[model samples]
Target: MPQRILIIEDNKDLAHLLELHLRDLSYDVTLSFEGPKGLAEAESVDYDLIILDLMLPGMDGLEVCRRLRKRPAYTPILMLTSKSSEVDRVQEKPTNGAP
Candidate 1:
């Protein structure tokens, strides 16, 4: 069985390109354009790996990671970031629920 991969990226072009490459290598890939939907997809399957994006529409990658950790997704997460200030941006977000 091919190893399953979930890519949570808002960039459709990048996500699809990555998916194509991974598929060429005989791996199964699933893509989600938003954090909330990605989290839902991640929880629904026991993917071998999760490729998360730092910036997303509904929620941020760190928040998704936090929620998964709360339930303990049991899947490895490989977070991707393009910005140098990703750390600062992630830290600024509110946790423990929306205000």
Candidate 2:
């Protein structure tokens, strides 16, 4: 079966382009324009991967990722954001003896 992917991005053009490329790679892609809608879709279906935009209507990508992580079903998340600070925040990993 083809791998299922969820793309939550507000940019229509970018979302379409990403869908096209992922489809070419034999992935079943689902797109959402905003965070709330995306979060709803995520809860309803099982996706192997989630591509989330950091800046979104209703809720931000970080909140979405946090909520997803809290769920029993663990899905891999790839955050898309232009802000370097946001990337840094998301990419941070705990060091030894660090909170």
Candidate 3:
């Protein structure tokens, strides 16, 4: 089966672009525009990888990452953000280091 990937980004254009590229690479991609919806999707399915954005509507990527880490299953997460500070903030968190 193709590897499943979840992308949580607020930018519709960017999300679609990413989905297209991932699909080309033979991945089963899922896109979520907001944090809450992304979180729900993450919980419902088993994804091999999760592409998360820093600034989201309901919750930030850091919070989402933190919550995902709390789950029993471990899914690799790749955080995408324009802000360099956000990267530093995520790195500071205790959750099992970034993937």
Give each model's whole-structure lDDT: 0.90, 0.89, 0.92
lDDT value, residue 88 of candidate 2: 64
Instruction: Name the candidate, 2 or 3, with the larger TM-score value.
Output: 3
Give TM-scores for every candidate, taking all chains together and pairing residue i with residue i. Answer: 0.85, 0.85, 0.89
Candidate 1 off by > 4 Å: 86-99
TM-score of model number 1: 0.85
In the range 33-59, model 1's lDDT, one tens digit per residue, is 999999999999999999999899999
* lDDT ranking of the models: 3, 1, 2
Q: Of models 1 and 2, which has the larger lDDT? A: 1
Best of the candidates, lDDT: 3
lDDT of 3 by residue, 22-63 (tens): 999999999999999999999999999999998999999889
- Decoy 3 TM-score against native: 0.89
Stretches of candidate 2 off by over 4 Å are 85-99
In candidate 2, what residue range of length 10 has the lowest lDDT sum? 89-98
True-vs-predicted CA distance for residue 93, candidate 3, Å? 3.2
In model 3, state the lDDT of residue 69: 93
